[model samples]
Target: MTAISDRPQMLPEQFEEFARHLGRTVEGIRLEFINGKLGIKPVPDGDHGRIIQWLNRICIQARPELYVHDQGLKIQGYRGGFARPDGTLADADAFVGRGDWATTEDVLMVAAVTSFDSETDRRDRVEKPRAYAEASIPVYLLIDRDSAEVVVHSQPDGVRYESVRILPFGKAVHLPEPVGISLDTEPLKNWVR
Candidate 1:
């Protein structure tokens, strides 16, 4: 019997087409492909939206040249993986004309805000860190609603991040170079479930 890991992954081009089709047909869900498995992201709740909004405000004030929002990226070092990071930090025009699945070349950071879903642990906590690291993205920010913590991952060496710092809500979190910004996470406490 063929194991799940042994199953063939859908090609990136094919996946993009399917995703576009789904985006047109579906209303509330988002799709992602990471580590050879398809992932479904449910519509975020109010607290989740607020967290992203707060982060965006900080990012815009700190670095107006950069942007952070839902942007699709091709990841995992040629694994046909595609991910729509809740917040993708990069140059303002980094994705201009790049189409749906933009290359990770200009990405400085990718943030994932955990949703109340069964896939959050695997998709945001595990697979995404690996995928973003493999793409050599400078930072991977995780705002974990489940635990009320901010996890900052940085310094990718092609396989994984060399530095990871976790701070509870209400503490300060510093993102490393390429995303040089200090976050006062106290407001984050108010956005958690």
Candidate 2:
């Protein structure tokens, strides 16, 4: 059988049109454009949803003035890419009036809860981090269920994250400036695969 892949399936404009149409017709799939390639992100499992919930609660409690979920961003710096982060931390009105793909400006952080899929490694762990960093997003929180770890990528210098800190599921993850908050990841252990 031919190998299924996440290669450059289509050009950026075509991808955007396809993604928009799919968003209206499809029920649970999400599309991303990163590194000039197309990626399909399936609806997350229950545990994956729970992890996002867990982080959402902590973020709300720590920074009541900001919101941390339900946002998409334009990324890959000048590459014209788009992504719908599992959870996007930004000012309450950061995406107000912006259409489906909003600019990455003022985005404090983006979180990804690994789905149990073949592309989890490359999509969540590899491409996304680079894309978010290139877009100068302050932080990228990876809830890697497969590895049972939390990988924090921060301090982007417009290329890649200069600082990366990985911690087991049960430890606390300290997010740096712009996203000045601490995550009590003890609850993450129960949700990992």
Candidate 3:
């Protein structure tokens, strides 16, 4: 008698491999596997890269209990996918690797600087916030270049988030966890434009 078998489960490592392959094979399609689904978006612009760099500098200077990670760092979700935030703050020791670092229990925060389009904003402000909350990341920051504002999301409830605070440009937003530090907006303002 023939026996039934379960489908092959894809782990985070395998999913990353698939993403790398697709990134090379696909044309003009920038895809990232996030929250067990493929998050496909167009490449970001100069403003996006600037914002990411600015935040990375600030985070590193702050020297929170967590290490500050810039580009090339990916955060794996609770399911089988992953998301590469513009900046991530996690335990320094957890992020040691040659190419990509594995998500660890100490990864407390993830931030995405949005500059693509309305759809990208929606994904960063709404969808990704929910995904990070579900992943149990203590904090999620969304920097909107169009609006020149930062949205800090905390207190995860199920798949959603609470304690939503919006900090407009020219104001300092204090992040919760690892260390209590405020982010200056002067640099972002100067470069965003």
In terms of TM-score, the best-performing candidate is 1
Query: For residue 149, what is the lDDT in candidate 1?
Result: 93
The whole-model C-alpha lDDT of candidate 1 against the native structure comes to 0.88
Arranged by TM-score with the best first, the candidates are 1, 2, 3
Tens-place lDDT per residue, model 3, 1-193, is 5223223245667877887777677775565566555566777677777777777667767774456674343454446456767677766656666355355356667878776565775578766887777777788888877788888888877577778988888898998764466898766776565
Q: What are the C-alpha RMSDs, in order, of all predicted structures?
A: 1.5, 3.4, 5.5
Better of 2 and 3 by TM-score: 2
Give the range where candidate 3 is weakest over 10 consecutive residues by summed lDDT: 1-10
Model 1 error, position 129 (Å):
0.3
Q: Which is the winner by TM-score between candidate 1 and candidate 2?
A: 1
Instruction: Tell me the whole-model lDDT of each prediction, alpha carbons only.
Output: 0.88, 0.84, 0.69
| Per-residue alpha-carbon lDDT of candidate 2 for residues 1-193, written as tens digits (9 for 90 to 100) | 5344544557778877888898998888888888667778788888888888888788889998788757767774645688889999988888889889888887999999888889988888888888888899989999888888899999999889999999998887899998899988888878865
Record all residue pairs in model 1 with backbone atoms less than 3 Å apart, i.e. clashing. Answer: none
